[model samples]
Target chain A: MIKRTISSIALALGLAVATIPALASEGEGLAPAGTNIRDQASLQRGAKLFFNYCVGCHSLKYVRYSRLASDLGLSEEEVMTNLNFTGAKFGEPVISHMPADDAKTWFGKDPPDLSLEARAKGVDFIFNYLNSFYLDPTRPVGWNNTVFPNASMPNPLWELQGLQTAVHGEAAPGQEAVVEKLQISTPGRMSPEEFRGATRDLTAFLEYAAEPAALERQSIGVWVILFLAGLTFLLYLLKHEYWKDVHESH
Target chain B: MANVFSRIGDWVNERAPNLAPTYRKHMTEYFAPKNFNLWYYFGSLALLVLVNQIVTGIFLTMNYKTSALEAFNSVEYIMRDVEWGWLIRYMHSTGASLFFVVVFLHMFRGIMYGSFKRPRELVWILGMLIFLVLMAEAFMGYVLPWGNMSFWGAKVIISLFGTIPYIGGSLVEWIMGDFLPADATLNRFFALHVIALPLVLLLLVVLHLAALHEVGSNNPDGVDVKHGPKGNKWNPEKPIDAIPFHPYYTVKDLVGVGFFLTIAAFIIFFAPTFGGWFLEHDNFTPANNLVTPSHIKPSWYFTPFYAILRMIPSFFGTAIWGVIGMFGAILLLALLPWIDKGEVRSVRYRGLGFRIALGVLVFSFLALGLVGAGVTAEVIPEWFPGADVTTWENAFGRLMVLGYFGFFVFVWVYTRFGFEKTKPVPERVTMHD
Candidate 1:
């Protein structure tokens, strides 16, 4: 009875655990963010973009600019020259000098620290939200978002994304101004595809920023699981040897 | 090396009198049926995780901030500033989920084998108490983080006490020790999480073991090994086909431990957040008093009960039925030994009604857990027909809440009334299929 139940349960447990990876939080018209946190080059591009644009308002206070340098395969000199817009020290956190009160006055609210934003709002949400921005003349920021409606922050990458006009259709009969999609009217230096790649890279960087050790830990976890597998093999042999006496004697 | 260990043992025995005897009784000579199998592993695996949680928890407490102001930052500080603190934090956080997973499995093993029957009733009761304390400990530990979920989850859960009509408001205020969930609640929860609950857990674990040891084990066959006659002179004290736990089960459990650690390490290192099941996405943000997140889902472990809590319609004076249903759900599990009246202990020999009931119960529990975690049931669409998604979802949830309680009620009814032929249990532990 014990043997049958155990074998059955172990089999079921294996199948149940196998299903977890498939449980991606897919919903609505949200695009899949295939973020590759281990891709250092993509992460580097993301870091560059984040520091250049987002840092003017938002901050990554948990992350050291110097640590970012090493993790993204850049030297202190290169980081100092390129990404250090606000003149932060190499060892200091990636915080901008823009004061909160002043920023609040400008944007109607202080832009939250993006240190844990990727984790808090999720990578897909961030990836989608950035791309969901559209032109809305009546709004204070002159922009609205499909992902986050009435967001206070303007489309900071509007120059690259150009002007996106919101195409609307009724979800039901009475609903007005329900956006169906976005279309770029006047394109900027970067095309839509290039902007998507940039956002993906930014998403990847935020994924890394949320937990910088994720890439390293994922790499090390393979070895750790493998080592445990080795120990499991040895113990299996030991168990079979011990159980031999009981089986033969019986 | 062997002689030196014996000498040290003898030296210790001289001072500590009967140390060897105690060790023999608890470890070396403790005998169990040779037919014990995989599910037996989780008992020891649970112990392994408890040790991991306690050790990791102690280290975390050394650095953890008790006040709401620094709690979120303190976690970040530990993650970044302290050496290997990220690993420790992941281990503890990840271990909390793993602990429940293993405990749930262990309890399932009990249900599968009827380990809660007859002479083992006290063991079941003690195990139930341990589970209760464990839930409290996990809740308090979660609050220590002071994240969005931490603060709000505490507020929402503690506010359940306020459902008591006359005394409810004061009780919640007393529990929080302030107008809302603030530093005082955080500090008190910290004390209980670190100091009080762990002591209860330790005591209950000891008692659980003692009760089980006294009763020997209920094997998969649901037969007591100590029945009939003792074994031959070569193995005089133990019953037929029984083996010592130390060399046999200990080694067997070690392989299980290896597998468990493999799974745990994978999560802790690769997906500690487990895509927001083990660690919720909302927990990444510091607690904000003014704004609540769009949705407040409990951790995956609590989802089933959380579902039960939500199943009750507000028309039943809002909170009263939900609170009653939530507590009663757990209380049913605790009272199962007396409630279940099946002639046979193991499900292997249980009646047809029992088999079907068990299947539904497991399904309902898992379905409820998923639904609780904001996963909609696919079956609901087919059954409900015309209603909007959320309405159907709530209706399905209500149906599940009914099935969940109906399972316990069925156990009580089936055990008392159902008739089924019992399988002829063997006298000795036999390996042959």
Candidate 2:
């Protein structure tokens, strides 16, 4: 009976632990980003893409160029010559040259800094948002996203991924057409598979930008945990040795 | 080298004559119950985590910017620019979460073995005060980050004061020093979090340990070792079933600390955010007064009480009752010593009713935490298709709330009406490896 009671209590506690993470999820079916921050090659590719395409409007204000160079395994000269477009100092953060006031006038909102976007919204959300842009005649920017509908900014990577038009499902009377899927109307320089990979690389870079220490912490953690486990084993032996007195007396 | 150390020790002992004796009284000479089980590890572990929080918090504050405008960016600066700052910051965050983890388990042990009965009531009361102050400290420390969740969480919690009858609006404004949580609030919270509350927590912890040492520890079997058959090797007056706390428990607690730090290091290094439970994802964004998060809930530690506040419906044109229910939940736990008035201390000897009631309380507390976290809101629709989500949540949540409060009532009735059929307790503490 006592054993039964303990099992029941454990079951209840397990149920409680299992339920809390359910809040972290959303109903929207986001595609997997398949991005790895650990891949230096992927991160380098992402950095190149971000500098070329996204840096025109968005900023990575928290990510410093010097730190980026070190983390991405690039020399200062290579990063400065190839990736640094705005002539920012090596120690300076990646701030866009596009004036905030101008951005506000053009887009009706200032394009947000993308430094912490990957942290705020998961990498999957960024990947899907980048992929979901479609041509829309009614939108002011002539572009709309299915992931983040009515987004103000036009597709910045339109040259690479090409133009997409929404395949609308049947709508009821007086209702707007529901987007079933995005169909590529105009293919760009890259193939469909290549574009997806490019977007994943960009997402991976942003993820790294969000928390640069992720590259270091995991490596350091292994040694720390190993040391602690060893110490715990030794302490357990000492505790057992000391407890002999109590056991002997008993 | 030994002679020099002895001389220095003697010098200090001459100035402070009670030092060595006090150490002996608390450590080497102090006798603890021999049969302390796994539940006993949490007390020492809580102390270890407290030290971790204090040490890490000091390093964090050295670089942390307290003002609302600078705080969020400054945290990022620390994460990126400051050398090894991410480790310190993660340790503090992970320590804060783990503090509650160990403390909750410690409190559960107290309840399970009846550590708060009679002689140890003062110890329990002091512990409850520590819990209260620790909650305040944590809330203030959270707001110092100036993250979006921090801003909104501060607003929602402080607005609980707005449920006051007449002074509601003014009290909230007085607390924030503004209409909303802003620079003034952040500065004040930083002051309280760093300086004022930690001092109180430290004082209460010292007093709690002093009180426990005075009364001696309660064992798993709940036998009063002091009054049992006496006479040990150390002293004729000492309980036979007791051992010196230093060599025995000191070594034992070292093992516990090692295991604990292993888990803590795992969290601080690899999974510092604990998948948004420890350091929330919304908190990554800078605070914006213009927009509110879609979901605003307190940290996981506060969720059970937050659920209690939510589950208690507004009555008589006032939401004050809900606020009352929230505070009352904690107040009830603090008053456990009085509510559970029985000769039989441990659950091992306690009647079946007591056991079932305590189990229900544990289940309810954990379930209520899930409710407060807004998990049920997301889950109810998925589980029961076409169901009125709010209605389903409210019904289930309110029942859990009842179960939480009902434990105190049921225990009172069971003990008062002699419904308890306590087994005969052993004169000596039953020992096991």
**Clash number for each model:** 1, 0
The 10-residue segment of model 2 chain A with minimum total lDDT is: A19-28
lDDT of 1 by residue, A85-186 (tens): 887788999887889899888878988999898888878889999898988987987888889899998898988778888988867766665888899998
TM-score of each: 0.95, 0.98
In model 1, the runs with Cα more than 4 Å from the true position are: A1-23, A170-174, B1-4, B232-234, B314-318, B377-386, B418-421
Chain B TM-scores, listed for every candidate in order, come to 0.95, 0.99
Put down candidate 1 lDDT per residue, B120-215, tens digits, no spaces.
999999999999999999998998889999988998999889888899999999999999999999999999999899999999999999888887
lDDT of 2 by residue, B15-105 (tens): 9999999999999889998888777899999899889888988989899988888999999988989999999899999999999988998
Alpha carbon deviation, residue B143, candidate 1 (Å) = 1.3
* Model 1 accuracy (lDDT, Cα): 0.84
| Candidate 2 iRMSD in angstroms | 2.8
The RMSD (Cα, Å) of candidate 1 is: 2.4
